[model samples]
Target: MLLRSTKAVFTACTLVAATAFAFAPRTAEACGGCFAPPDPPTVVSGHRMVMSVSQTQTVLWDQIQYAGDPEEFAWVLPVKPGARIEAGTSAFFEVLEAQSAVRIAPAIVDCGGGSSSGCSASFAASDEFGDGSAAPGENGGDPVEVLHQGTVGPYETVTLSTEEPGALNDWLESHGYNVDDSSQPIIDQYVAEGFDFIALRLQPGQGVKQMTPVRVVMEGGSVTLPLRMVGIGTGAQTPIVLYVIGEGRYTTQNFPEALIAGNLLSWDFATSESNYVELRDQALTEDDGRSWITAYAAQNFFNTSVFDANFNSTTLIQFYLNQALANGELSSSCALGLGYFSGTVENPCPPGEPWDSPACGSVEPGALDSRQLGCVGAEDIAVALDGLNVENVWVTRLEANLPRAALSDDLTLEAAAEQVPVNNILTAQIAINPEEACGNGVIPRTIDVSNVPGNRVAALMTTALASIAAALLLRRARARLARR
Candidate 1:
């Protein structure tokens, strides 16, 4: 039940889509807290945030900027014990988004027996780090315990723990972080729950422009996200995209899941894309301003080639095992052996040796090496994890739009194993039209109408007939009276 959480920040809003698709499956839980008032505010417009959570790990990526001074850019994150921090490449996210992005294809509606008016169709398509060093700090007897201090990419990182909340704020302020009164309450909450803090700041002479994507790996039972901390800066609402890759789909444990009305899907005639903007917006709105929407879910088999150019059985086993370790599905010790067998083996890969090395190869003679037993040169790790069945591997994506009020709460994921099927891939994309228009070229026309002029003619004829009848009745009455 060890849970890990990752936080990422980026520079522009355009990267939201790409960052959203970069996720791994793991279990997650929620923690309560608020962020200190940033001097210039951390949250801003045109910023994108993405998070991924499974049973054992959680990953978060977001965009950040230095609003005040280059030296003022800093971030504080809450994490469980055994957290590992490192820089990540942007290519990983870009590739995932491209592979998993929702593809919008124009649909053709033929109005049979039509002259020129019938159908409409269209088509469409589409981090930071800092040096490796830590400032000298006092140790021992301090309310806060500094576990690790080092440079990751362009940011200086410090992992610390303390039972006293006030000491945490002081430690952060002493370490050159902008910790205001607002941060204390949040710090207290985490402290009460025995959570550790990871404080990050730009290295000397390093600006936010030099910031890169950072990954945080922690050990815990459930995924925990400190969204309230994200609200410390200025902003009306923040858009959050999360992808959960696991055995099955995941849903929100704390918030309601946004219900998507796929039935309302319509084609946008102007843009040649599905007019899903309304539907997406409506789903986000109906959730009462804060909710998680399961946008996409399915099992995906990734080709081992994606990880290694010279793919082989040894490489394939190593790749899947490494992913499993990163996601907390497999332990480091087990990963070294591809987590295939639990018993002792002779001539195992030496400590620090590559997993694909012959030393790590199976000792069974004439039998296909571990790589052969595990199919190599395949698109996915199915052969390596044949025991789990490749068909059952799946990834789920969730999305949310949060206002400042909603940021006070934490986000957690809950999923059941039975919800997923083996050997199936389910992918979904929200179809929002850049231009709102229903694509069908046909405009509705009124077929039945009664004109005012026609009504006037009928009224005149009825009046004339009534006048003639009245005159005849008067004549008949007068003639009868004379005869009498």
Candidate 2:
């Protein structure tokens, strides 16, 4: 009786422990040693460099390995002992990686007397693939009966032809398929335009302009096919514009005086990254001795990224963007990345006059509003390139105007004083004050008379508009006077 009682208690205890564990929360898995980023960034030997490059030592794997992450990745200097390190602020080269796997889902199916394997395909194992503009070769592979190679359009549904159409479920179960469920993930992929690799081909140093898109074939199941493409040089300031637009990285960034005078060098996205995917896919094509990837995803990634490179190091650091834009590029592009004249009184002011004047001058504490007057930090971004001939640059100005002045006035005042439609009133600003305003309901304006030197200037007052016009006499005189 004692032994049976002990056994029953042990069984109950085991069940209780299992039940408790089943409901316990799981911990987030720590990601380590899973990915190695793209190229070990280094200063290219032959590239031009204008900024005084710096590097800091970061020991990894117990001093067995050491690397330097630059404040910015451009023409960067490698890490050497006793070398100055670049200060890191934002981002660095990161590698996108994934573990390839096969998955299937199970369901009820009536496989009606079909051949083994349930499904069939016209199979072709070829040395050639990724025919961007090329047709499939007639002699590539032996045709096999295949179930699916295309989308299930309405007209092509299996409902009309097959009596036992649930063979997809049967095939999936037999193959132990695990479909990546959740329609949201697939839809999100399309909306985000996210890809493991973006294939692009471009001329050397062309950058974003040449970044063409390459697509992957996603059937019912996950298939990581090899992709390859080429991109062209966009030469835009932010090469990664389209990829990061909704994320608020959109801006006109400028890099002024980043190059040295005399050498004319241009920047380009390096291609070493794509070489990886090309080798991994080991893809073949219809073309004899051709690999499947013209450029593989692993290989194509290299073309999608931006690298600050020197086209000509000795050229004047002050190079202009190919086409001048109305506004400047990124703020840091001029002040930080290129290392222009910053850290002045315009930046974060350190307890001084002018910049640190009155608190009521701005809406935010310790920040300058656009309306305030002082040595502006933004002025530094306006690079006055000496050699460029920028003709007829329109400088925009904003001004506030209210015709009646008083909200109580029942006045229908329409004012557009800037551009004169009539020949006489180009600069004429019509100010209509109610009869009661000149004295009764008027508030006196506090005009600073400090520049008038003790307010000694004499005032010659004209009471009537017709009298003022008569003093000018001719229409041309009135028109000329209207200018002032």
Candidate 3:
């Protein structure tokens, strides 16, 4: 599908040494439609980033969302020198979201007296996450040394380093960079702290305007995120979503960690909305709005069905064959045959290879080109899987709403004390009564409060709801028997 573009500024910050951050224009929606309550100066709503850390190596993928003149789009990230930038695909985020998004099962309903059997409904898992936009401001500098300059996908990239204060800005301006005036201090701070900067913009004449995601591979496994630079062009209550792939579940080290009280979660039958968001807000508010929630955590939990469908060895071979056909390198589709004493071995199967293997399958007039297998999106899948070390890796999803003032310090990440997994599918314990939903019954009832463990009121409410539901079911069963 084509991404709809608009006219607005993109702003954001990211780090290889310390995690990363991103910002969208005030008019644009923040990362994945996840945002904190609206407040003035909250120009940047939220952003999504993926970080994979194994041993001493780290790989980060940041999706650069931009809505404005393509020429005006620029992005800058801080790294610990020697970081390499590469192209990343949106499929990585899309697949991850589909697998770990918070899902709610429909409430079980019961009618006191009715011809219909008490309702028990279920729904397919679905979510409406959004994307955030961000681009860097420009300027120039004298002592700024351009370390490495090259192209990655459709972006023109340059890595710069400087010890002199304000020299980075001068060099950026001289090179036609459009960094914001307010960002000079942040840039200088990184320089003082010994961090190299990688800047990017659209390659002239690339034709594509919308910016895609980029990957940064660097040494060191520090999980600190540079939030100070995030405040440069963001508003209060900035939302941040991070997906961490590591050896174990990672949580906030310097900041407080918050988890949504599952027992407090309820479904509002009237509005068809869950109290998940409200509970999330309350949890953060209780922590003074400077905490990260371990939204979802698990190990060996990726759903590779999408990747498998589009990028297996069979699909790769088919894609290569299709490309060969289009190039007229192959006359027609080919198949491998094995029999006792074949008349002539004309482009026969490779010797000793299994007949079912792709290696043995050759196309008419020529062999399938191995280089063209990348056209099937196999490379992107490989990048995500390999970079993340998907085998036996622990994946953690973290979220937070940081007020502008709270962005004073960078966020540090560390493995959680307990290595337990947190499920994203939240089943509401409280159920809104249908009568109450229609203004007839009393307050909504808590059907199953077992999640709360020690509440007497919850136990009583659970017993009452259970009795009512049992009576309804008994009546329905009796009516069915009578009819029979």
Which number leads on lDDT? 3
Q: Write the per-residue lDDT of candidate 1 for residues 83-138, one digit (tens) a residue.
A: 66655433233323323333333322333322211133332321001003233465
Against the true structure, whose TM-score is highest?
Answer: 3
Candidates 1 and 2, the one with greater TM-score:
1
Off by over 4 Å in 3: 1-46, 110-121, 124-128, 131-142, 205-210, 303-391, 433-446, 449-484
Q: What shift in Å separates residue 471 of candidate 1 from its native position after superposition?
A: 91
Over all chains combined, what TM-score does candidate 3 have? Answer: 0.65
Residue 63 error, candidate 3, Å: 0.8
Model 2, 360-442: lDDT tens digits are: 23233533231221112222112111111112111111101111111111111111122111111001011122111123344
Residues 1-484 of candidate 3 have per-residue lDDT tens digits of 0011112111123721111233221112222111111221122222457876654446677764433233334567777777777766554554455445555543433433321111333322223234311122232333667777778767788887779998877767666665567778877887787778787766667544335667777654556666776665555566666787765788877789877787766665655556676677677765678877887787754322221222222222233233233323234643222111111112223432323457755434433222222232223333333323333566787877767677777777777888887766556666654443434453333345354444343223332332333233334433544575
Question: Model 2: residues >4 Å from true position, as ranges?
Answer: 1-184, 188-339, 343-484
- lDDT (C-alpha) at residue 442 in model 1: 37
lDDT of each: 0.43, 0.15, 0.51
